[model samples]
Target: MQETPFCLTFGHILPYSMSDSNTTDFTNPSTFILLGIPGLEKAHVWISIPFCAMYAIAVLGNFTILFIVMIEKSLHGPMYYFLCMLAVTDLVLSTSILPKMLSIFWFNSREINFSACLTQMYFIHCFSGMESGIFLAMALDRYVAICDPLRHSTILTNSVVCKIGLAVVLRGSILVLPFPFLVRRWPYCRTNIIPHSFCEHMAVVKLACSDIRVSSYYSLSVAFCLISLDVFFITVSYIQILRAIFSLRRRDARLKTFGTCGSHLCVILAFYIPILFSFLTHRFGQNVALHFHVLMANAYLLVPPMINPIIYGVRTKQIRDKLLRLFTDKGT
Candidate 1:
């Protein structure tokens, strides 16, 4: 959305207007402006280059993972099943924001319809929550495999993995479905200039003329309840996995066990560190530059999708070998 100097609010007189309450009729605007990046207006042209590159890599990388896992019979298991789900979620999350963001940078098309914005907001949050859930599932997969190797196959069968994937999607969608409706019901009297790249929940909620305590609290509650819970379980799983590794009598076996977790640990850090930073910076970093906060917010969205495949490709021998063989076969 394009930024404007002024916006009209209901039941309030326009400054320097001669008309009184009897003469004024308030009309709610049909569209909102997404201010792409605060204070980086001049660099938008340069910014789009790297943004486009990252988007391209994220799509290609994630798609490769999905393709390999789907066709390679060797990789058909609970772990790879969850990885495939992660690739899908990353694709959705990246696609949800990057194209519109690019439009703003390239064509200066910043106007998004109110309904469209809410839809975008819903998908962004839902996909993110789903990714978090998928991470938790991966953690559980690793926990069962390492901590209880004998029962791993029995515990997480193909049917069970499918059920877990379906449950993750449904849980995320159900929890995030209310966010758009909550924002849509509010009367937006302030400037609809969202000071970030996308229709992030809090940024959009802050524009409401009415008290936003309910929406704010609800959003915070969901973040903590869902994201935090996912992180907690993942941490617990890793801890148990570590304990299991240490209990191994053979050094080679211990290293191999830790090696199995290496890729996941890289991915877990890549996904969560930026998220935690963005969450804290958005809430408590008033003294920090708004543009920096906005940049970090964009980073949180963009970085994980871009890096996940790289981490997997490098650290995951099956994926790495498949990628090499695929390319080599193509070359020959």
Candidate 2:
């Protein structure tokens, strides 16, 4: 949020190398380098155009969905309530990295200040974590709607939904806030160039010149706790969902139910599968998985927001109709 007067990303490399210390405490740097996206094989202008377009579309599209949900009384159902949360999370998620990323790509300015890096990491992880939770809540909503239609209203009550939203906030805030602080507390005397596009925790930690054993342990532990918990819940939910889907005898009824859950299930797989692989690769450090690992990690971040709206737009009649109405309306 700091404007030009407080411009923090105007520096060369750090004075210390990884040889000096195995730890990096968060000392505010003039800028940290981004050694990503730039390496992608494309003309600078070509990549900038597409990346900027994607950022613009991500914001506009997610914001429009949020606005439509807020203004439309008919859209006040639990499904839409969750959808609004998803859209808002998408907007927040993309905003965290896109602007800085686009700026870097366009201006060849990869240097991000230490405080800026920490700030970016905090929200990026927060929204990313929040999205994982929201997806789980969404799957649960689908399950209740499909399997126990009779109890849908009672199970997903107004207060219950509020609690779910609160859980999303608390989950991200409580687990992730301590991380940037811990990183900042460490002393790093190494090159400030980040291997990835954004201030990813693991990547940044690797740059530290001092003993980072505790930080690494706690950070990895926190990551495992959140991601492992998410995967477990999502897997259990889908198992029950599949069991219910298969148990139904009516073909037409089955197809109808599939129509409702298909997109959601697709979204769940799209979002979580890559993330699981990313985590596995990080933990095991298999050299063979390097390229594929980064690819999966990027997809876990970029693909979901891009694909979620498309899935909902194509699969849900209500969402499609609403989008159509917006585009076709005579007055704006």
Candidate 3:
């Protein structure tokens, strides 16, 4: 007696036996096929061009930020230390998806081992959460500097910064640690083809043969709880920062104070806006195109990493001066 094959459709698996040799039995498939943006498969080659460019820029830009902060002794403050953490997080986040994504586009390597897929899923979410925590840390640094300038040094000391970094890592890790384990418990006795580029949490969960409400609820809860709290704290910090800026009588002083936060604000918007859009669209926007959601998801991870260093270099006077001096000395 031939075993029945399973087909996954619309987030449910239906068992159906087919005599056709082409219909592969994906029940407990060892490797999953990642269809890189299902509807726009033909355009994957064209899409790879920009994705590749963004990835290159992100790697170079982040490495540049890390190098500058490391070499410039004056930049060894709590703020720059936080910036370094952000840069590292951005690098890990983007790298988690792009290399395999590019391979899927350029080389037609769509199959990813199940274990590898799970690992990818873990790293992407872990680093994403860490990135948000880093943003919150950066916001706190700005708030302290602007609102309590005299005590900023004493408050955000080197030891305190180290502790904050550790906390951010542990928080992100502990929150996202359950993802892979939860996913591993399910039996993926359905079609092992994921429609997006990478192994996203919900995407992989939808392939499971069992009830996915646990995975869905946990993911939603984690996302909402972590992001909401981070955003709330960041908002309060900035509000206090704004109050401090407004309290200064001199217009120039106000401008200077607010200008210091400009880059952090831009980077925060770049990070959060696309992520929120993608998350909401994925969950609620059923009418929206699948390709659009995939593109936005990829964009959120790639864009911030690519442009963060640019925003900082352009908006922060110290970084700009240092970058210019480095280039000038090289040219000479």
Candidate 4:
């Protein structure tokens, strides 16, 4: 008699047949099983509490940022426009992963259709690239505003901002367009069980029967090229900005100028540090715990979106003041 196939569910082994009509194929799965943090299976419910809270905060905060930016005409500038773009990108990025993640954790719905997995992977990566580009644009906005204050208005007009936004979108979309296609072509003749809560590209690719060097190399190249170039440009822009700020005659002017960059700096650190850590962990941390890598990956998506609005709201004088007045009027 043929042995029955089994799968792990909430720390219990259950008979899971691959031959069932509704089930995924063993050779080339039509659906993949997400393990939802392998070692921490029993704690998925507890884990999801914080994840759910973060998702809620991300949604509410990003929408709030969008609403504030839209209503406050005074914020109709290059920096705020880039911020709105960032907010939208964060929303998409977090939303792409969190809902399904929660479903897996809370309901034990580990099965994700193949095409849907690719869609999730695409959105997550695409918006992540877009976020990076937006950060570069925002850095440039600050650079121009501080270094060439006189021409700031002329240099980053509404038309120019729109074009920059378009460029960011196009660059991200075009580059990431290949990822799903590449992954789809791979033969997943290995197991369909992915030890992750979401369809992370490498996680899915690892299950392919064929050699994944092309997919791996492509992903690494894209990440390195995008991040390295963006970081270099942002560094250059900030160096110029710092020079301009220090060259100012008045100490108060320097302080005020630096203050303008504080929120952006915080946001940049919040976004990049976790993501870089997660990337390195995924690529090189072979001995690292699987749960650690999974947690970090989720954190990069969740933490930034949740904190970005708070960073802007608290650090930006105009936004803070506007929020206060809006709430105060409501309280009356």
Candidate 5:
């Protein structure tokens, strides 16, 4: 939607008047333009190649993990159930961004309606919080298996796992549900170009014409509080697990115990470090390049989905052997 420029004669000089019918009003809906990776116009084509590849791998890998876990009776335990949930979250998170991203990158289709933009923002943030919750749940599962091996089964029964899953969903939904409603109430009278690949909370809020103090403060508080709590619990769980491992007399016992948690640790580090860096850079680093911030935000979304399954497949022998056997059977 291009604006038509015109000039009006006043007293001494003629003033420029531009007609922008698409510009939003306080009473009506408007569309937003998503500018994917500012200052990278020349590299959009090259950048999208790797993004497409990673998205494909994430979809294939996570679905493979889900299928294997569902079909294998041995993998029907609590740990694997948590893994399945993680895969589902990764799939949802990846799908929420990639299709729109590819459309923007490849087709230059960047105009999104207001309601649609808010929906994307809501789900992306919601699923991200859910992933953090799932990580905490996985941490607890490992802690129980390692620190209280005798009661692991009793503590994490099917009913308990279902409850944990429901709690994760509710925690994420309750915290993130207010964001879209807040944004909807804001009158966006300025330019609606969001300088990011997706509809991020801050990026969208920055487009508002009204005061956004509450939106900013509340969103920041919710994010930090949730992430801090999850990380705190995960840290405590790992600390106790390490203590339990150290108490074992045999080296083999200690090695085997730590091995069970290695894949999860790899995933946690991969997921959290980039996310924390992205958020910190966006909120605090005034001198950071726009392209760098955009890249990090995207990595925070895409990298974990692409790498989690690979980590589990490579490190967990049960998954590895099952995958190999499945491939072998398909060939035969």
Candidate 6:
């Protein structure tokens, strides 16, 4: 419910405190206090339960992927290498937010210090950028495998694959690490109340007392460079893949190509679509389009990790058989 400003009366003849005219102070407070849980403060318990459950599932799913990929020697190929890297990134991504988010949802005192906010923001960007790079690696791997099947082994050497993985991690970290520094230099108005569950870069930046133009530009630059490069590279890889598949005489080869690429395409759409939606909504729509934005936020993080294992488990016979045996035998 909306609350009215307080009023005072002196024997039915009241005067507004001239100092209550301090609207400027309220607007430019030293700290932006978050008055959280607007309508359903009483429903916090119910909210907490589901939030905890979802987060638990996210953690477990990603962790399980990492475990299975590591344990099975048959899965030590390039595809599963990328898959495991992605699982690692997924775990980091979810962990960066979920524990703190769970804390806020379950209990009160949702105060996050400036340092903590910056830490969370930095890691979130780092892991996300890494995911993008790994996706590009995956695309490149598929491209080489499909388009150059004669010498796929020689071209995509284990050493070469190791270098590719290293470069992806390094480049991603380099691209995103500067963002936190740019943000930290600003003299924030001490508003700790993040509009979202975690300290999103733009949301936190928007709360700065100083002009965020430079920071915003940096953010936009990173997004444009990483995402555009990822999309362009993926598209180029897939186009070549298509050409290669068409050159084949057998119909099954085309079906095989479609099956392999289709899953990657689905995962790509799952990630980038929600991310782009969030970027646009947060930047342009203000508070108006937030419901969808929030949904997208959850989708971007959870869906990839949740669906990825299923994809591999269903499609890759060895993984399916291994999972079955592992579950059935529970090694004594």
Which candidate wins on TM-score? 3
* Model 4 segments more than 4 A misplaced: 1-27
Per residue, candidate 5 scores C-alpha lDDT tens digits across 1-332 of 22111111111121112237435344335777777877786688899999999999999999999999988999999889989989999999989888988888888888888899999999999999999999999999999999898999999999999999999999998999999999898766535667778898888887666678888899888888679889999999999999999999999999999999999999999999998999899888857877798899999889999999999999999999999998899999
Give the alpha carbon lDDT tens digit for every residue of 83-108 in model 4.
99999999999989988998988898
lDDT for each residue of candidate 1 in 214-249, tens digit (9 for 90 to 100) = 887889989987899999999999999999999999
Model 1 segments more than 4 A misplaced: 1-28
- TM match of model 1 to true structure: 0.91
> After superposing candidate 5, which stretches have Cα over 4 Å from the reference?
1-29
Q: Of the pair 1 and 6, which is ahead by lDDT?
A: 1
lDDT of 2 by residue, 1-332 (tens): 21111011212222223322223444545567765442352454565575566667767667767777777778787887888888888878777877776676577676788889989888888888888888888888988987898999999998999999998889878988887988887655535666566787776766665677776788777777677787788778878877888899998887888788888778878878877777787667645333354445666777677777777777778777787887789556
- Native-referenced Cα lDDT, model 5: 0.85
Task: Provide the lDDT at 3 for model 4.
Answer: 16
Model 6 poorest ten-residue lDDT run: 2-11
Q: Flag regions of model 2 displaced more than 4 Å.
A: 1-30, 38-44, 283-296
How does each model score on lDDT? 0.83, 0.72, 0.85, 0.86, 0.85, 0.69
Clashing pairs in 6: 32-191
Worst 10 residues of 3 by lDDT: 13-22
Where's the lowest-lDDT run of ten residues in candidate 2? 2-11
Candidate 3 residue spans exceeding 4 A from truth = 1-27
Instruction: Give TM-scores for every candidate, taking all chains together and pairing residue i with residue i.
Output: 0.91, 0.84, 0.93, 0.92, 0.92, 0.83
Candidate 3 lDDT, 1-332, residue by residue in tens: 22222124332321122233314444456777787876777898999999889989989888988999989998989989999999999899889999899898889898899899999999999999999999999999999998888999999999999999999999999999999999888876536777789999988888776777888889988998678899999999999999999999999999988999999999999999999999999888977877787899899989999999889988888788899999999999
lDDT of 6: 0.69
Error of 3 at 43 (Å): 1.0
Prediction 2 global C-alpha lDDT: 0.72
Q: List the residue pairs that clash in candidate 1.
A: 1-33, 1-34, 1-110
Which run of 10 residues does model 4 get worst, by summed lDDT? 2-11
